[model samples]
Target chain A: MKIWALQDQVLNPIEQKSIDSFKAAGGNGSLETFGNDPYKQKLRVAIGSPNAPDVFFNWGGGNLKEYVDAGKIADLTPVLDQNPELKNAFIPSVMDGAKIDGKQYGIPMRGMQPVLLFFNKKVFAEAGVQPPKTWDDLLSLVDTFKNKGVQPISLAGSQAWTELMWAEYLLDRIGGPEVFKAIRDNGAAGWKHPAVLESLTKLRELIDRGGFGDNFASVGYDMGGASTIMAQGKAAMHLMGSWEFVNQQDQSPDFVKNGDLGWTAFPAIPGGKGDPSNVVGNASNYYSVTSDSKQLDAAKKFVSTTLHEDSYVQALIDAGDVPAVVGVEDKLAKAPNADYTTWIYNTVKEAKHFQLSWDQDLPADDATFMLTQLQELFLKKVSPEQFVNAVAAR
Target chain B: MQSQRPSSWYAVPAFAFFGLFAALPMVLVVYLSFTSWQGLGTPTFNGVANWSRLISDGEAHASMGRTLLLMVVSWAVQTPIALLIGVWAAGKQRSRAVLSSIFFLPLLLSTAAIALLWQALLDSNFGIFAGGPQFLGDPDIAIYTVVFVISWQYIPFHTLLYQGAARGIPASLYEAAIIDGAGRFGRFFNITLPQLRYTIVTSSILMLVGSLTTFDTVLILTQGGPGTASRIIPLHMYITGFSGFEMGYASAIAVLLVVLGTALSVIVTRATGFRAMSSQQEGS
Candidate 1:
């Protein structure tokens, strides 16, 4: 049985360690690394190659649908039903995405909150302002930042997904978590919902106010670009993924060293349907065995061992990742944002419902279209009605 | 001892390789263009549907238009500037060596490295050339930067061609012109221009082919962004074929590109008298 682990950057440093561990455990599974940032899209390895990895890493959303439809993955329904103990080990929503037509195809690994507001405490202090908790309050801060000649939010407009963060945040604020789930899940009730359109309209207002950095569209989503604006204290806030915090710690040790980072929940829309707990994210990198693989037994065992409590904790800890396993000892004693992860987990735990990542849950072709449509929305090239209509067309 | 023409049978192996790699694949692409293949499942015959989509699709038209524009921009804009520098560097030994080395520097860098360097250079915030306009972000300015990047890399190749072409012209032509009271401009227009025609046409054709099909540089630089402003056809084909996974649609675009390229090549050949000269046996 040939087993291939299509791993991510978190597993990159300790690849040999995991591989050695797998080998010591008498496994035939081999590991092959893929993307560094799981949130970012990357071209999957070429298909039908002699060296095509049997089991691979895939996003847990509609991306799975594309690959599954392509007939490149193995169905794990039989194994999933047999091992209820294994199924109980990880987050349910994560595994939910891996299931198509009641058949499990992937194992959920690390979970990341892709959209969170990280504000520079020092910048807020200098501006003589409090962290805003309401839509009106944030708008006031926007005015204050404008008066002070600083960008309110350091956004990378060029990054297709980064721009969608605002829309998702606003969706949660206006319609609460239910609306988020409805819209993200492609539920018929949510597509034409006024809350989604209103959310986009509000985001447009922010763009009109120049909340994003000047020429943000040119900036790639990296440590060197708009994220640098926050690290350098040029911007008051950065709404990005949790991975930015991990990367920031790696790149500029001293700049964010103090972990002076403060998180304010995206403000609730005035007279809207949602609560602050309505969140936007999912289990980060989901792993699956290809249906094309000759070795289903080895693939299942490989997943079990790699995600075993002890091995998962060690690997996740070494890589500064949040393990998806239900109960693991929190050994992040020295992690600067250990509290942040805790808060994130707690917030997710308290949420009434989980809204799968909006862009991910949509049809694969629609993912790019939604991102592009939002671009037009931001540029005023398309109105809110037009944006909704365009998505509907897709 | 004549070896019976060295046996045309010896050409079989080379012909076989070409057929296997190129001819067979090209025929397959044509077939694929008329079918719907999602790069995975067995292709379903759709016939003319992909072609019909190509005609109606805004993105497809944009890709073809961009490819043509890039061809014109690189050949018309970059080649002439390169020629000027090449002409200026022709006789001065030290200057030629220095200018030649400087011009060739960009070609040494990998496409990724060149893009990273240019991104830094064109970065709207901290870049050296950032102040006047946000080059990469602005659709208007983005193509120019792409043009500049393509041109900068092509300069050395063009310079070498021009230098060799100028040198290939007979010194006797210049000497005879000088004696006939023809000045430098007269010698150049009457002598240099006519002699370098074949080289210019060949190089321009090469440039046109190259610029039309270029992938790595523009892809890295823009990824066909700022709302597909710099999305050339090849990049469009890539996004459709790879990202969108519409192999048949992408192949249709590819076939159209090949047709466009062949037509342009023919036009260039006739326009530059390349075809006439070759027919007259002036060309080797």
Candidate 2:
């Protein structure tokens, strides 16, 4: 049995060792691993071919929905039903995306990735500001940081999806979590919604205020370009997902250890329909059994074996991740930074609705199309109406 | 005529290779272009929707303009410089090998390696030389950077091609021109320029095709950011097919690229009056 996984495990070498140990000690039959390096599309092509791996990893929503629709993925509802313990092993909301037509198709195999508004505590202290608690606070901080000769935010503008996070959070804050949900259901009608328009309008304001600074249009996230700015204090804050922490730790260890890399939930919008506690990002990474895989039994056993394994969860925490496993709070307390870990755990736990990132929520083509429109919006080449019209036009 | 005809057996291996590799895949692409599929089972036949979308796709249409712009810039900048180097290096007897190797080193490194090297060197804050243009970030300058890098990598190749033609130019013609009191400028125009006409046209055609389909470097460096400023056709196709999972649409883009490349090549060769220079040679 060959398992295809994201490259993060490769970065944390011991995690692979844990997986290899699981494959050996569990006696889940013979197993092999082939993962990392191949681009997402290349991986999709491989899974679509006859030589598809028995089990593969994915983000579970936009990437997996088409696979499930095409019947190329196995329904994991049966596995979950047969083993209640396995079903209860992960947070229920984290598995919501793994369902297609109300049947589970994927198993939560990695940590949660909720988007966080990370700030530089030293910069904020010097500028006499704190992490924003309300939308107005965040808006005011933009000007305050600029006056203090700091870029308010570091945006990975070269990657459009990083830009899309703003819209996701903005829409969620203004219209609540259902703005994207409605849009995902029906495109044109959803695009015309007042909340959607308001979100785009807000994004433009952020750009106009130099919230991300003038140079943001060229910075990229793939090589930690934006992360560097945030860590080096060139930028006072960065709006990014949980992965930003790990990335910063890798890029600037000094920043991580002493630079006060603080995080808080996205700020609240006044007069908004959205609950302040609503969250958005990648809910979780998952492993799905392919329809054409020859080693179905072994693959299912592999999933079940790794689900509650203390070693697997511990490894994820050690890698600076907040695992989606059900009882991770106590385990997270023992993590490197217990306060940050607890806050993240509580943020996800208390969330009324956790919307996935817009790019990962919409189907693939629409996702790509939407990202382009958002990018154009940031560049100010497209008006708010035009952005909506382009998205609705699709 | 039948008795003089060569046996068809000689073409079997060639034809087999073509059918199994080139012809088969091209046919599949053509078929795939007309249908809606996610690289998985049961492609629902969606007639012309993909093509129709490409026609109205605003970002895509804009990206097409950028791709052609890149092609034009590459042809203008690369060909003349390559010819100059080829002519210069051709005249060098002692250091020809070393000069050629040094010039071709950029082409030898992988695209990923080159992209990384340039990215580090051109980093605005932390690059090797420090503080210059954001080569991979600014949409306005990013495409030009790509053109620069592309020229850097491939100029040696074009130079090598021109060197072959330059070496073939009869020294007798230059000697005759010298006897006629032609200085360096006069001899270059009368002899070197006319002699390299065929090579320039051929290399231009190659360079144009290469520019149209370029992906790896831009993908690594920019991923067509700061809006669609650097988003060329091939990168768009990859994003459409792979990220969007619209394989059929991607194939449509690919098919259009082939048609466009072939059509332009024909038009260019004809416009250049390059209907086989051999015929002109015979006439002279």
Top model by DockQ, which number? 2
Model 2 steric clash total: 0
> lDDT per residue, candidate 1, A81-192, as tens digits?
7888888877665566677767787886555454578888888989999888788888888889978988888877767778777787788778776765565556444667
> Which tens-of-lDDT digit does each residue in A272-309 have in candidate 2?
99988988889988888988888787777777767568
TM-score of each: 0.91, 0.93
User: TM-score of chain A for each candidate?
Assistant: 0.88, 0.94
Supply candidate 2's per-residue lDDT for A176: 86
Error of 1 at B231 (Å): 1.0
Instruction: Please state the CAPRI-style docking class of candidate 2.
Output: medium
RMSD of each: 3.2, 2.9
Per residue, candidate 1 scores C-alpha lDDT tens digits across B194-245 of 7878878888988998888898988788877676778899988887776666
Considering every candidate listed, which one attains the maximal lDDT?
2
Candidate 2's DockQ? 0.58
Instruction: Return model 2's CA RMSD, one decimal.
Output: 2.9
